[model samples]
Target: MHKKQKGEAAVITLVIVMILVMVGGLFFGLPLWNRWRAGIGGEAELRQAEFNRQIATLEAKQELESAEYLNQAEVLRARGVAEANRIVADGLGGPDGYLRYLWIQGLSKGSTPQVIYIPTEAGLPVLEAGKR
Candidate 1:
């Protein structure tokens, strides 16, 4: 009976020691576990920020390319207008001839009433010609 009591006492002592070890580990390891979780969260945030920056850079590049294309189109349009003006000038013979052509065109439209006056050699309009 005495030997059996001793074995029982040893088993009880072993169980109490295991409980104490578990408690001590909880007191020390909780902070380390929290820190590890925080590191994971921070890495995720960094990855998201990098992705946003890449998107912004790509958007800016696309805007610059669009502006370049618009500028090229404007340059081409301006060149075509200048060439058309040069051809018209050559066909009319000179600036004076172009002006005379414009005057004749305005008279042909006749969208409104206008006073008719014939110009003299001195470049003065003969306003009294209709009365004679």
Candidate 2:
């Protein structure tokens, strides 16, 4: 009977050990897994936010370049128009076809008009004789 009792005691001890192992695993593993998942989620969100900022910056730069180009084109147009009128008055065949005031408006879908002008003469446009 003592042998049988000892055997039962050993079996009970094994069961308690297994239960403790399972409980310990549950206590430690879950929090670690949850922390890893949260870290991954945070990293993904940070990457997405960074990408959005880069895109916005690129878009803004493109807009600024486009505006600069438009302003330059406006200056060219003003010069071309003056040159055309001058040539027309100077008996130069009434301003060549290439000297006509021309413009390309609306480069982007939402952009404003862009005007451009090309003069007929080789040199830059000259101011009116006495107008400075």
Name the top TM-score candidate: 1
| Pairs of colliding residues, candidate 1 | none
Q: Which residues of candidate 1, in runs, are more than 4 Å off?
A: 1-23, 99-132
Worst 10 residues of 2 by lDDT: 97-106
> How many clashing pairs does model 1 include?
0
**RMSD in order of candidates:** 6.1, 14.2
For residues 1-132, could you state the per-residue lDDT of candidate 2 as single tens digits?
999999999999999999999999989999999999999999999999999999999999999999999999999999998886777546644445324332111334436543434354876654453434
lDDT tens digits by residue: candidate 1, 1-132: 999999999999999999899888888888888899999999999999999999999999999999999999999999998888778767999778777887898999989978878889999998976667
Residue 62 in candidate 2, Cα distance off native in Å: 1.1
Task: Determine which window of 10 residues in candidate 1 has minimal summed lDDT.
Answer: 94-103
